[model samples]
Target: MNTTLQQAFGNIDIYLFDQLLKGRFDSCRNVLDAGCGGGRNLLYFLQNGFEVYGVDLHEQAIQNVQHLAQQLAPQLPPDYFQVAPVEDMPFPDNTFDLVICSAVLHFARDEAHFDAMVRSLWRVLAPGGYLLARLASTIGIEDRVESLGRGRYYLPDGSERYLVDEQTLLSYTQELGGELFEPIKTTNVQNLRCMTTWCAQKL
Candidate 1:
């Protein structure tokens, strides 16, 4: 990758990059990264004049993101990046035009924890806003994952993750009064693991 491109988008999720190419968030102003880690997914948003906010459970991660934000968007207040958990964000309801939870939901310890985190993300999104997420799932390699009970699974990749399926995502979309902005797509990595992209728009 070219240095300029790398600087513009620092290791951003490729699926999220696809949304940018489609101008899915062109009208968005306020953006929140629910589980931002060193703001890897935030460089483009910050440099492009988006009002960016981020939260992470790790204090050091928040500090790192704040530092990155300072370098990329000095005008933003330091409080824009905070130390918090996805299940309990500090922002008000319907606060952001775009809420990103990439590669984060799969860390849920169980079904309840996952539901709490999902609801919290949804609660902060404005009506008609977008929620973009990429998380591990048992989509194409169901048989390759061993159930640990309560939505947790041990996968062939030698890791444990709380995996969701197509039906689970669809159910949440319906229950949250959201619509799928893009059909759920999953990438199976050599039968070791799978990651699914879930893009939805709040109604």
Candidate 2:
């Protein structure tokens, strides 16, 4: 059977974390692959020596990973995953050493939902743990204006996104008691239309 685009997206995380953030992996352990579609990222983290756990709202995602694990000869290392939404995670407070909500926050339906997601992520973070979030920050002003909706932005990909600005992100993390890192500018000038990201460390 052919894999889906969602599966390919999960595989892309392996590339992003391994390549984009490879130098910074030293700060993470007991990682949570939040919005972990298909569990490919948990496998990536496991291979990189992190004790990982993954969670997603889709049961199909969990089943996909389970199938992948069952097919592997060498036990896929130590990892656990569950089905749950971002606003309400199943794990206890301060459960993860690193929480990655990559490309997921924009789905929040409203301000309250968005606030809850930030709070939930912070609550499960161990002191000094990091939360890395990437969003649709690369869209142009014309694009944003044309796609405005009920308190959010609609992307052409049929993915509802919240057009978050850099200052807004910094304010949330700072108010929540995190030490925010400087933006990592894209090294390639040609890829200027890249998502803006923030790495906040819980204090």
Candidate 3:
């Protein structure tokens, strides 16, 4: 990665970077990163004057994000970041224009937990808002994973995750009353694990 680019983007997910390139979030002002880990996906937004907030279960992660914000977006108050779970974010209803949950959903203990987190993310999103997520899925490596019951699976990579399939994601999109902002896409890493990008806009 170029030094200049790294300073600007700070390890943003490539798919999310693609969305940035496409101007998918050009009109979005308030952004919330649910389950933010060290604010890896937030550098660009913070630097560009977006009203950015974040929440994480880990206290250390929240502290790290606050430090990152202080360095890049000094105007933002420290309280903008909180230590909270994705399943129960502390924000008011329909507050943010963009909700980002990257590489976090796969840690769900079960289908119910996953649903709870998704609903929380949706609840805080304003009308016509975008929800961007990346999570482990059984899309391309369906045969390479063993079901552990309750939507959990043991992947060939020797890691366990609550993996969703293409149909499941599409069904959820419909259930959430959201339209696909972009076609659902997945990247397979050496057939070890598959990560899917689900970008949807609330109708």
What is the number of backbone collisions in each predicted candidate, taken in the order shown? 0, 0, 0
Residue-wise C-alpha lDDT for candidate 3, range 1-203, written one tens digit per residue: 59999988889999999999999899999999998999999999999999999999999999999999999999999999999999998899999999999999999999999999999999999999999999999999988999999999999999999999999889989998999999999999999999999998999
lDDT of 2 by residue, 19-119 (tens): 33556657566788788787655555655556677778889887676565545423544236678888788878888877887778777777788888889
Candidate 1 residue-wise lDDT, 21-40, digit = tens: 89999999999999999999
lDDT for model 3, on a 0 to 1 scale? 0.95
In the predicted model 2, the residue pairs found to clash are none
TM-score of candidate 2 against the unseen true structure: 0.76
On lDDT, the stronger of 1 and 3 is 1
Better of 2 and 3 by TM-score: 3
lDDT of each: 0.96, 0.66, 0.95
Segments of candidate 1 deviating more than 4 angstroms: none
What are the RMSD figures for all models against the true structure? 0.8, 5.4, 0.9
